[model samples]
Target: MEDQRIVNNEDYAVVLIDGVCHLCQGLTQFIIRRDPAGAFRFASLQSEIGQELLRQGGFDGESTETMILIENGKYYTRSTGALRIARRLRFPWSLSYALILIPPVLRNLVYRWVAKNRYRWFGRSNECMVPTPEIRRRFLS
Candidate 1:
């Protein structure tokens, strides 16, 4: 609820993630490293702002297992969101967007399986990730 006005603008895309999941945190870091232009911003699914964004995008705010990308007023979820994000990344990493050509039903099957096991295989933090001083500005409070 920290003033949702900022999210309405199309200045950048927003990535909503399971902040406590180690894999999700790593993916955020991965995007940051590859995106020097800072075209993406982030929010933890449990945060007030995140839930608001989720609700605005017509998704279930309570579901944290799925990754969501909000761009230009449209929202992409699950594997589609992940691939769309990859499409904006640098070079070879951006090439991963090609996977989007596969059917969503097939792609999401793998995504769902990994999401189900992520907490067990990668472990999660008791609290959401705290962005570093250098990257803190990129996170929505």
Candidate 2:
């Protein structure tokens, strides 16, 4: 599975997230629910593939506590990452892309505030999220 995840970079989008973060895990699940076209692939930041991707993108894996979107060889982080994912989701949820109009500094201010206290506010999981068998193939970790 790890080998499969390490293939040559392609056109698909990959989401890299903190494996034990409850909020991040929940956001992954939310994306799965809304990504009916299977437009995304996922990996925990702790996974080998996740680490490799971050390295290739020149990002510090340990320092990236927020969700990350890797698309067409570019990486998007913080609120930008979230909005990119949201724009690809189905139906009404894609409407969330409208929030992109807000200044990135303002958006990231709120994002960083939530992220700083995410573990205390949303808690953590001892293990990474386990996708249902039907959707397990979509996850790389």
Separately for all candidates shown, the number of backbone clashes (residues 3 or more apart, or on different chains) is 0, 0
lDDT by residue (54-104, candidate 2, tens digit) is 787777869556888887667899999999999999989889999999999
TM-scores, each model vs. reference: 0.94, 0.89
* Candidate 1 runs further than 4 Å off: 1-4
TM-score, candidate number 1:
0.94
Put down candidate 1 lDDT per residue, 95-134, tens digits, no spaces. 9999999999999999999999999999999999999999
Q: Rate the local accuracy (lDDT) of all candidates.
A: 0.90, 0.84
Global local distance difference test of model 2:
0.84
Clashing pairs in 2: none
